[model samples]
Target: MGSEQLFGSIPPNWEYKTLGKACAEGGGDIQTGPFGSQLHASDYVPVGIPSIMPQNIGDNRIIEDGIARVSLEDAQRLSRYRVRVGDIVYSRRGDVEKRALVRNHEDGWLCGTGCLRVRVGEKNVDSRYASYYLGHPNVREWIVRHAHGATMPNLNTSILAACPFLVPPLPEQRAIAHILGTLDDKIELNRKQNETLEAMARALFKAWFVDFEPVRAVGAQFIAPDIAPDSMDTRNPGAINRAPTHWPPHILDLFPDRLVDSELGEIPEGWEVVALGELVEAVKGRSYKSEELVESETALVTLKSFARGGGYRSDGLKPFAGTYKAEQVVHPGEVVIACTDVTQAAEVIGRPAIVRSSTRYRRLVASLDTLIVRPKDFRITKAFLYFLGGTEAFVSHTYAHTTGTTVLHLGRDAVPSFTFAKPPAQLVQKFDALAAPVLERIQATEQESETLAQLRDTLLPKLISGELRIKDAEAFLKGRGL
Candidate 1:
C-alpha cells in the first residue's frame, strides 16, 4: 500500500503539508551540500572540523568512525554548509531515505559532499519530530519511490522539498519527539557506556598480559609479592620506591617476579610463549549458495557482522534458508573471527568480534568468511581470548599470514599458529573473573538498547500517522516503566 493509503483518515487538528510548504512557512530551506569544486580532496586534513559525508549519516545519528576532516580555513570558507543543531542531513545519492539529525556537539560540522541538509524552522516545526517522521516506513518509501537515477537513487532539493509531510500541532510534535527521544537517549547512553566498558577491559588486558606491568613491579623489588606498592609511603625517605599500584597485592602475587628470554621477547618468568591452538580451536563456517539466502528466522553471520575496528553489528545479519552443521551454529557471547577481508585497509580480516543476540532471529550460523573460535582448554576463558585476539600482535600476525589480491584470505593454520605470551592459569582466571562481569554488563545494556530501539521504531509510524494518540503512547510507556 502507498503512504497515502497508510495514512487513511487524518486526525483532528492534524495538517497535511508538503515539505516545501512547511519550510516556506518556517523560513527554512532544503539545500544541497558543498559541491566538489568548493571542497577538494586535498582539503581534507588529519585534524580539524569533521566533514560529514554520506557514509557518516546513519539512522538518525552521525557515525563518527573514520569520518573525514577539513582544515579550519576550508571550513570557514564553506561556513554556509555548516550544519546547526536540529538540522537533518541526508545522503544525496544512494540510501537517500536515511538521514541524521544534527545534535549540539555536531552543530558546526559541514554538511559535506554527496549530502543534503534540511533546515526546519524551530518556531514552526520541531526538527526532532521531522527526523522521526522521515524515519517512518511510509515516508521513507515515498522518498525511495521519488528518488531519480536507475543505477544510483539520488535526492535533489526539489525532490525532497516536494515530498509529502504530515504535520501535527507544534506542542503535539514536541510531545511525540520527547517520547521517542527518551528511548533514543537511553540507547545512546548504553552505546557510550559499552564503549567505555570495553576500553576498560582492553586496558587491563594490555597492562597485565601485553605490558607485564605487574611483573615489572615485582622485578623492581620496591614491594614484596604479598604487599601492594601503594602501601609504601613516599614521605618516608627509606620507603621511596617506584612501582605500579593498579593491581591489588593478592592479584599482584599471581605474577612471576623476573624477566626471562623467549623467541618472542623478554616475557615474565614462568610465562611461556604458546600457540593460540593450545588454548582454543577455530571452526570454519558453512558456504551457502546465493539462492539459499532468504527471509527467515535463522541469520547467517557474515563479514559485515564485524564492525570496522572490532565489535558485532546486528545490521549485518542476513536471513538464511540454507542447511548448516551443528558446529556452524553460534550463540550470543560467542567469539568469531573474520577469515576474509575485502577492504583495502584489511580492517575486517583476522579481527575478532563477540556475537550479539538478535531480536529478529532465533538461530545464528557463521558464514564461510568467518570462523567460530571456541575454548578447547581450561587455561583460557572466552573473555581473555577475545581481548587477546584484539591485541596488535595477534592482528598483525593474522594480517601477515593472509594471501590474496583484492580479497585477503587467512590461511587455515593462521589462527592456530599465531603465538602469544601466555600468562599463568590463575592469572588468566583472575582476569576473566574481573573482565567477565564488565562484558556481561555491556551485553545486557546493549540488549536493553535493542529492546528500546524496537519499541521506538514500533511507536514511530503509528504516532506520526495519528493512528496512535500521544496520551495513549504515554500511558503505554508508563505501564512498561519506560
Candidate 2:
C-alpha cells in the first residue's frame, strides 16, 4: 500500500502528494548508480575517489571507513552517477530505507553499485528537508512496504518516484528542517566529543601501563639484551649504565625505583603478574523470551551494545521485560564484555563496552550473550578494567582459547584466569584519577545526546505532518531552553 492508503486521515491544511511531484521542481535528479557493465571490482583503488555503497549509509551520515575507493580516472568514467554535497543517497537494494546525506567530504564521489541518490533545489525545495523527510520513520516503512523483490528486497527509480511525500510550504519546510537539524547537530557534537575523550584516555593508558614512561623518568632504563650501555652511573642506585642519574622528587615518587624480570618482560619491582580472575570475574546474564520484552526506557544490554572501540553503542539498546535480579543490573561506569561474536575466521570474541547512563529514569541490565565483569574489589577501577580487557595480551588469549565451529564463544571461566601485569596501587590510583573522568565525561555527553535525539524524534513527525506549526515548535523548544 502507498503512504496515502496506509493512513485514512491527513493533517488539516496539508496535502499528500507523490515524491515524484515534489522532486520534479528540483535542480538535482533522482538516479541509481552505474550498473554492472559500467563498473567493476578491478577499478577500485586504495587512495582515490571513494565509492559510496550500501554499507556507507549510517543512520543519518556517511560512514566511509573500510569502504572501497576508486582511482580519479575510473571515477570520471562513471561520472554520470556522481553525487554532490547535498545529495541524499539511499540503498537501492537489500535495505531500501537506509539513507545518508552527501556532505563536503563525500562530494564528487561515485554513488556505488548498490545505492541511489536524490537531490533537490535549495530554492524550490529545501535539500535538508527533503533528506530528512525520506529518512522519517513513516516514509521509510512506506518505502519498505511498496518495495519489490520476493527473496531479497529491492528498490528502483520508478518505485521511489511514486513514494508518497507530505510537503509544507518552502518556508515551513526550512523551519521544520532547522528544528530537527539543531537537535541532530547537538547530538553529533556530543558524539565527536566522546570520541576525543575516549582517545585521550586510551593514549594515557598506553603511556602509563605499556610504555612505563613514569618509571623511566625516575632513572630506570631498559637496555635491550643485545646492546651494552655507553657508561656506568655509579652514583645512582637504580640507573643502568648511561641512564639519567638525576630526577625530580615528585617524578620519583610516582613510580617504583626497582625493576624485576617477569613473563611480560621487566616490570616494576613490587608489581606482580596475576590472573584476570583474581581481580575481576564475569557475572553471566539472564535469558529472556521474545514475547516478554516491550519497548520502553528500561533496556537489556546485549552483545549489540558493544561499540567498535571501548564504549557502548547508542543504537544497540534493547527494551526489557521489567523483570531481572539485582545482580543482573549493569549501572553506569560498569564494564560489559561480549562473550559471543561472529563465528567467522577472525577472532574478536571478547570485546568490552563500558556501560553508560542513558536517561535519568532508565535502567539497564545485562542479557544473554553478555558477561557483566565486576571488579572483585575496589583496587581496579572500572575504567581501568575496560581498557585492560582491550590490551594486546588479553585479546590474544581470547582468540587462542575460543571454541565452537560457527558460533564462536569465549568461556566464562577463562575470564578470571587471563593473566596480566598489575601496576603498583599508588600508580593504579593515579591512573584511575586521571582516566576515569575522561570516560565519565563521555558518558555524560552521550546521555545528553540521547535526550536530544528523543526530542528530535518527537518533534519531527509533528512538524512534517503540519500538526505542529513552525511558531509552535519554536516556542516548545524555547520553553525547554533547548
Candidate 3:
C-alpha cells in the first residue's frame, strides 16, 4: 500500500514541510545542562523530585523508576534546565536518535548534562505532532545519518533543528499519536496485570510455604502434648489416636519460634543454609569452535535457550550432531543458575530453572556461564530451591560473594559456603507442591507476552514502511479481535 492509502483512504489535507519551516522563526532552542560533578549523592533524596537523564529517555517514552532526585537547593541552581510540559528531550550523545516527549507530570522535571531538551515555538506546529514526526522511521534515519562523533555518536542543536519531516496537518498528527498511544496503553495495562498476578502468587507461596504457617498449624495439631489444658488429646480426643493425626514431637518441634540470622539472611526454622557448591557441581560447557553449528532432531540447550519464565525456546537453536549423548546433557528437573555477568544482577542471576526436558551439548559440556545444581538431599526440593534463587535475598548475597575484576564470576569454591535456611523435608515438599502452579502460570504468561511482542515487532516495520496500510491494520486487528 502507498503512504496515502495506508495513512487514510481519503487523505487528510497534509503538507510536506521541513521542521525548521514549521516551527516559530528563532523559536527552537537546544541547550545542555550541568555535569554530574555538580551533583552529589547526598543531594539526592527519594520522593523529592524527578531527575531526567539519557537513561530515562526510551524510544518514545520515559522510565521513572530509579530516577535520580535533586534537592530544592540544587533545583533552584539548575532552574534553567528544568523541563516543561510538551517539551521534547533527546539524547545528545551515545544514542542520537533516542527521544522522549515531556508529559503533563514532567513539568517540574530536571535534566542532566548528557541530555538536550528542545522547546518548540508555538507558531505553526503542535508539540504532539512534532514528537510523532520526529519518532517516524524516516525522520529517525535522517537523524542517524547526520549524527556526528566517531567513538560516541551525537546530535547537535543545528543537526536537530535542520532535521527534515513530513508536516502532516496537526489534526492528522494527533490522530496517529492517539492510535499508537492506545496500543501502548493496552500493552502497559497487560504488563501491570501480569505484575500483579505474579506478586499475588509470590505472596501466597511465602505465606503457605516459606513462612511454614500451614505446616506449622498441622504440626501443632498433630504433635500436641498428651496431657495439657489445650492438648489435642483433650480437645479432639476421638481423632487423637488416628494415624493421620499422629506426628512425632521431634518433627513438630523441628522449626523454632524465631529464625536465626546467617551470612545470607534470616531463614525459616529447621532449614539449613549452605554454599551453592554444597548443593551441586559447577562447570562450564565446551566452546563450539566450528563456525557452522549444525541442528539435529536432538535439542541443544544454551544460555539463550532458557527464557526467564518460559521453559526452553528452540526457535533460535543451532544444529548439533546425532552422536550427542545424555552424559553431555542437562536433564529435566535439574537446577541451572547463571553464574557470571553480575551487571545483569537480579535479571536471571542466581535464578534457577528445573529442566523440564533433556538437552544435548558438545564435548559433554554444559554452558560455561551457567552453574547446574544437583540437590544433595531430598529435604530441599528443586522447586523450592528455584523460588529461593529467584528471591532478592539470594541475589544480594550472591552478588556480594562474587569475585572478579573485569567480569564478576561466581567461583565454584565459593558456592559451597553460600548459606540458607533448611526447612523440614515434609514442609519443603508442601512448598514445592504449592509453588508448582504459580510458577507454571508465570511461565504461561511469559510465553503469551512473548507471542504478543513478536506480533507487535513483525507489524511495526510493515506499518511504518507503508507496506501495510491502516485498513490492513484494522482488518488484521479485527480478524484477531485485538
Off by over 4 Å in 2: 1-15, 34-46, 64-68, 92-95, 121-123, 148-153, 220-252, 257-261, 295-298, 322-325, 343-349, 360-362, 399-408, 411-414
Q: Write the per-residue lDDT of candidate 3 for residues 1-482, one digit (tens) a residue.
A: 01212122223455444555555442756666566687766678876668887767864667675677887778888898888877888888877787888888788788766788777666556676567667666667778877897888887777776665455455545545554555555656555555554454454445443555434445455333221111222122232234243334444454455555665455655567655556555544434544435555544445555444323443324455544334446665566766655353234444555554323322323455566666677766666777676666566676676777756776555455566656667766655654565555545554555555555545654544445556677677668766
Which digits, one per residue and each the tens of the lDDT, describe model 2 over residues 382-466? Answer: 8789888888777778767778887878875667778777887776776677667667677777888888888898887777766
Name the TM-score of candidate 3.
Answer: 0.66
Looking at model 3, residue 131 earns an lDDT score of: 75
The lowest-lDDT stretch of 10 consecutive residues in candidate 3 is 226-235
Segments in model 1 whose C-alpha atoms lie over 4 Å from true places: 1-6, 221-246, 341-346, 402-413
The alpha-carbon deviation from the true structure for residue 314 of candidate 1, after best TM-score superposition, in angstroms, is 2.1
Per-residue accuracy of model 1 over 35-110 as CA lDDT, tens digit each: 9999999989999999999878877999898888998899999999999999999999989989999999998999
- Where's the lowest-lDDT run of ten residues in candidate 1? 231-240
Ranking by TM-score: 1, 2, 3
What's each prediction's clash count? 0, 1, 19
Best by lDDT: 1
lDDT for 86 in candidate 1 is: 93
Candidate 1 local accuracy as lDDT?
Answer: 0.86
